[model samples]
Target chain A: MKFTCDTKELSRACNTVSRAAATKASIPALEGIKIDIKGKEVRLCGYNLELGITTMLESKGDSEEDGSVVLDAKMLCNIVKKLPNALTTIQADKKSTVTIKSGDSEFQLVYIPADKFPELPKIDEKSAISIPQAVFKEMIQQTIFAVADDAAKPIYTGALFKVEDGGLTMVGVDGYRLAKCHESIDYHGQPFDCVVPKKALLEISSLLDESGDKAVDISIGLRHAAFMIGNYEIFTRLLEGEFLDYEGAIPKSHATEIKVDVRTLVESVNRVALVVSEHLRSPIKMHVGNGQIGLSCATSIGAASDTLDANISGDDLLIGFNHKYLSDALRNAGCDEVRLQLNGPLSPMVVLPNSGDSFVFLVLPVRLKAG
Target chain B: MKFTCDTKELSRACNTVSRAAATKASIPALEGIKIDIKGKEVRLCGYNLELGITTMLESKGDSEEDGSVVLDAKMLCNIVKKLPNALTTIQADKKSTVTIKSGDSEFQLVYIPADKFPELPKIDEKSAISIPQAVFKEMIQQTIFAVADDAAKPIYTGALFKVEDGGLTMVGVDGYRLAKCHESIDYHGQPFDCVVPKKALLEISSLLDESGDKAVDISIGLRHAAFMIGNYEIFTRLLEGEFLDYEGAIPKSHATEIKVDVRTLVESVNRVALVVSEHLRSPIKMHVGNGQIGLSCATSIGAASDTLDANISGDDLLIGFNHKYLSDALRNAGCDEVRLQLNGPLSPMVVLPNSGDSFVFLVLPVRLKAG
Candidate 1:
């Protein structure tokens, strides 16, 4: 295989695909990136059992023969990144030795036959939906943090994506918190629901463009899902299990509501949480009354108290919460002002936009010991 | 004790002293910063058994009483860093509760009485010598990287500071490489030699001013060394042992010499070293002939080669070296062009400035296996 391309372009493509490469596996070929050269096109692919990423780039140098080889993903990426920013040529001989040269530097590495690489699962494109890259990225970022990392319940490790008519809603729920975001897309297919692994969504989010001018096509199959980016394609196995009924779990009624600036409340909570050490798991208390929220936390080492102004319209209430969960929700609210709904000290607090239903965040309060 | 000071100034002082605070110690007071409130001057001190740092800042608010307390260094630094950027007041009540307030945020932390904090050693200033902060800082940086991290010989872990005839020479030597830096200062004190711990020199270097106008007063006592910079004072125990005879170890003549651009040689060595993995322990070989140096490295995984232009004189030589040692010496040369002097394959390669003796870096060659 003989191909020449811009050193930076090759480096970027290697980085993108290597994210899916297995670091340690029984099969050695799973840790390699397969490079296939044909005419003027070169395709690079990296795949573990659960996820695969592939990208194609045009070569500038002419090739006398077409061939394929698998090289160690990490070494190839590092070598390319360090090479001088110039045109680089890579040629593989029949002896299973690959020579890479750029400027005055050259590297020769051993490679494995591409036939040893595992084949990626075929993606059915019957159920495909296109959404703007910016919107999709936002949807993933707002909900992915709530996914449970524990493997005890495998279903909770993935986010649920539900599409109906022209609207798509993504929900992530651990035991203590739930985050949901909805966006409208131009879709005219049967409604479907699928669970995407958190790892896949995170990788997809990083590859998405935030300019809002480009769109990504997503296809959901029976057992696999594929996301088609501009010049790259990411494929992953769909999670198989029953997901939480997030719609029914959300509280619909509230006894008290307060509107507060998101930044102000986030800062206050962060200061109060400083006293709550990891070894001593203490909850931050919030007293909402007289148009202000008094936040306080006392631990063995120290005690902190902060107050923030808010617009209140109902009975005063007192609540306790795990500061991290509350902080995450407020930061992800993505609005200037947020409305917080509380039923009582034991009920889950709901965070909503001041006017719209674009996003919803619910955090369960911690039970505080009586003073 | 009560005082008000600029939040930023107090935070900076805390960070400076906290570097000497013990992370985990049997004496809890050693992990805390002692704050002494007297009139309008507030002093903060952090001392482990081996090293201590103290700095003073001016307070704006009047105090009703003067006292001292020791607070947890990490917690105080974090709280001060997060507090609003305004005048911050700290007050300690008779109950041993310290209250810190800034804007609307308040933190009450339990403190230990200052009497429990260790006392720092007093240094006699009769043998004090002054040097420009920028010059001393450079001298430390040029040699510190060569200090041996292995604690087999405690003396080798510290740099030897030799002062005679208004000249200060700092030398750091491990078994394989040696780095020496010297500067001319305006001092007439008695000649003295002492070894300062690497940890202390690093902290002192960071606190030194980069601008050449400022000067730091350094006093060397029988067992302790002190550095006074602006409003901060740093004290450290002097390491006691016989040091390497660095001057006698350096060779006076060479059979071959070459002049090359520092940056070019550094980049070539870095690229060649990429193939030398940690587990493989391969040495990079330099073949000097035909007015260019050919660098190459081959390991079990792969091979890399690069060629750089140089001005060669005398006999052509082939030398092998550990890439890291070579890279460090070349980077610390601190010059646009460096002269390399070589005697033979087994002899140490000395790197020096093109003109003067401001710095000298010597790296021993690694013996190569027969081809």
Candidate 2:
């Protein structure tokens, strides 16, 4: 088997698909990226059992015969990136070795048989709904960070996607902090919903080109989902678990509220965190006074305190929370000012963007010990 | 300490001396930087027992001080770096806490007793000799990379600073690679010789100013060496052991010589090393053919090979050596063209700059198994 293609195209395609390649594969062949050359097109496939990524590239003006080979993804990437030439010629020898030559440098790499490569899963695309890439990317970025990283809790490890008469809502909670983003998509054509695993969503998000003008088409089924963008297609196995009713869990109203600058709050938390003990859950206490904001953290190792002038008008209240949650929420809130809704001490608080209704963040307050 | 200074100046000073601050100190007081605010000057000192760093800021310009305090170096650096203004006031309260205020942000840091801070050792100014900072910095950079990081052998962790007969030579070896540099320096009417620890030389190298006109006055005694660069003084304890006689270790002549481009050799080694096994030292076989260079690394996992065109006159020879050493020599050899002087397999090869003098690098070839 013999094939030739542009060095840049091959490198870019392999890199994009190889993100799903298993680092420690139970099946040795799964560690490689499968390459198939048919007529004038080259298809690359990589998978990790749970998810599969496949990308195709056509010859730029020139056509070649059909061929197939499975090359080590890492070695191929390193070699292609370093070779200095526009056109790279790759020819397979005996189906056991692949020869690559660019300019004056040549390399012969061993290849595993293409028969051992895993088969790409099939998805029913009849009920697909097209969505703008920017809308989906923003929703994922705004909510994915709140997903629980632990696999012991299967439901929390995946973002709950609910589609109903109102809109589509994405909700993630790790028990301490929760992030929710709601968007109205063109879903009337075919009502669909699935709880996509955080890892799968991350892979799909990385595959989208933020600068491209193309729209992404997403299709969901009973136990599977497919995302299509340009010539790349991703298939993920939907999680099989019951999602929490996040709307009922969130607080409906608050008695006291304080508006604070998002940037100033994030910076204050970062500074106070420097002196806070790393092992203990970093609980920063917020004391809201007449026209003032006070932040403090005390641990066995050390203590730090800072105050920021603000236009706050309410009864003085004190609350303790994980500094990291507050920092993360403010950093990704995409708002100039954030409203801190307080129910009472020991109760959960809601932080919302002052000017937008699309995103809302919630944090569970930690109860301080009796003085 | 009670003083107000420009945040940028204090930040730069803290950054420069904080490298010597101990992260995990047996003596708790040593973890803090000693700040003495006298009538007209404020002195900051950080020590980890073996080395001490002292920097001074006089009150003649903008800083006004009249007291002293010792604060944790790590915490002070973090607070100063995060504060959001140019002028921050530091004051010692009656409760022994230092208050740092900038704009509306305030941080109260606990301070250790100033009396517990270690005292800086005094150096005899009569024995100090001045050397241009550029020459000193360059000599250290060219030799320190080869020093043995292994602390089991005490002497190997230091670079031999030999001063005799109006010349200074710095030699370092890690058993596999040797870097030696020599330059003539006036001894200021007195001769001295000593071997400074590798860590100390690296620290001094970083402290040297980029301005070419400035010079560092250095003094060497039986147990301590001090470097005075402007208002900063660094004192390091000497390693009490005999250094290796590198003069006898470097071979005098060679059986084959070849000249090659430094950049080309470095790039090829990096590419071929991708397949070299990690546990087994990365040994790349070099075959100097007629006007061509062939490099290959074969392992049980995989094999990678590349050949580049070079101007060569030596007879056909194959030598195996650690690719890292070759890459390092080529990267730091300061010359565009390097002439490799090889003795034979299992013997060390000398990498000399084409300009003929000032520096030399030696790399030992890996003993290959019989084919």
**Predicted complex 1: CAPRI docking category:** high
Give TM-scores for every candidate, taking all chains together and pairing residue i with residue i. 0.98, 0.93
lDDT of each: 0.91, 0.80
Q: List ranges where model 2 is wrong by over 4 Å.
A: A59-65, A164-166, A280-282, A313-316, B58-67, B93-96, B124-127, B188-191, B280-282
Question: How far out, in Å, is residue A305 in model 2?
Answer: 2.4
Write model 2 residue lDDT over A1-371, tens digit each, in one string.
Answer: 56667889888988878877887777767787888888777788888777878898766435365677787777778888877678877778774778777776677778888888887666765466666677778888888888999856787888888775546788888888889988886665545557888988998888777775678887787777888988888888888877777888789888678888989889988887776756755688888887777888877556678888776655678889888888888888877898988887877878887866698889899887777
Report the error of model 2 at residue A48, Å.
0.9
Query: lDDT of model 2 at residue A288?
Result: 84
Model 1 collision count: 0
What's the CA error at residue B116 for candidate 2, in Å? Answer: 2.9
Return the TM-scores of chain A for each candidate in numbered order: 0.98, 0.93
Residues forming the 10-long window of minimal summed lDDT in candidate 1 chain B: B58-67
